[model samples]
Target: MNGLKGLYLEDLVVGQSASYGKTVTETDIVMFAGMSGDTNPVHLNQDYAETTMFEGRIAHGMLSAGFISTVLGTRLPGPGTIYLSQSLQFKAPVRIGDTVTAKVEVREIIAAKKRAILETNCYVGDRCVIAGEAVVMVPSRA
Candidate 1:
């Protein structure tokens, strides 16, 4: 909670960009699997996944997306950020060895409403796996 700094209501600029990096590990996938109860064979069974279109076990869509939240919570918009809504598209598959870089950009700011519209993206080795926009409420500095 104390980690949030740099970002305040008046400091945000529309069209500004922010980025954060994270390395995804197998443990992250396994833990998310246990917590979300999505034990699909493709995510849990390497052998089964080898036979699927991906040809190997892949990370969960939501797990990859969660990195976006991590970036939002810790950087850019920071704490007191309330997620109003998200529109996303899962565009590619993420394998266990991949390191994902999640990015968010401020697209529009509603100064009157203390809200910001952000464009979000997740990339794995140059390929975009998730892209979306989120409407968030950032507490006014005043």
Candidate 2:
């Protein structure tokens, strides 16, 4: 994957798409928990998770959403992208073994001011675990 470093403000198209992903791992869950201070028992203590609605632990919703931001920062809008806002709904829990693929597609691009509307989704297998829209600012190279 290319590093997002030179995306100025004029390279975005309204129909472009970007995608990237990896398998979820317990280490990732633990690390994210430590970094974000979101160590809910369901995400850390397996014994406690065994009592939850899922009958096991589930990854944080924001963790899946992070994948979406990664795709945008490293692919579509690239490095110079600024996130304005985003809204997404979680449709399913992401287990530790689930391989999540995050994708973002441009729905509208405001070329005059270098802003864009993007539709984003995070999927685990055939299930759409999360989906939503995001507003971003892309800086032009020129």
> Which candidate has the highest TM-score of all?
1
**lDDT per residue (tens digit) for residues 1-142 in model 2:** 2463835556666677878888999999999999999989999999999999989999999998999999778787777788999999999999999999998998988878778899999999879999999998887655
lDDT scores in order: 0.87, 0.87
Segments in model 1 whose C-alpha atoms lie over 4 Å from true places: 1-6
Overall local distance difference test of candidate 2: 0.87
Q: Write the per-residue lDDT of candidate 1 for residues 1-142, one digit (tens) a residue.
A: 2675547779899777778877778898899999999999898898999999999999999998888887777787987788889888999998888888889999999999999899999998789999999998888778
- Report how far off residue 27 is in candidate 2 (Å): 0.5
Clash count, predicted structure 2: 6
Clash count, one per candidate: 0, 6
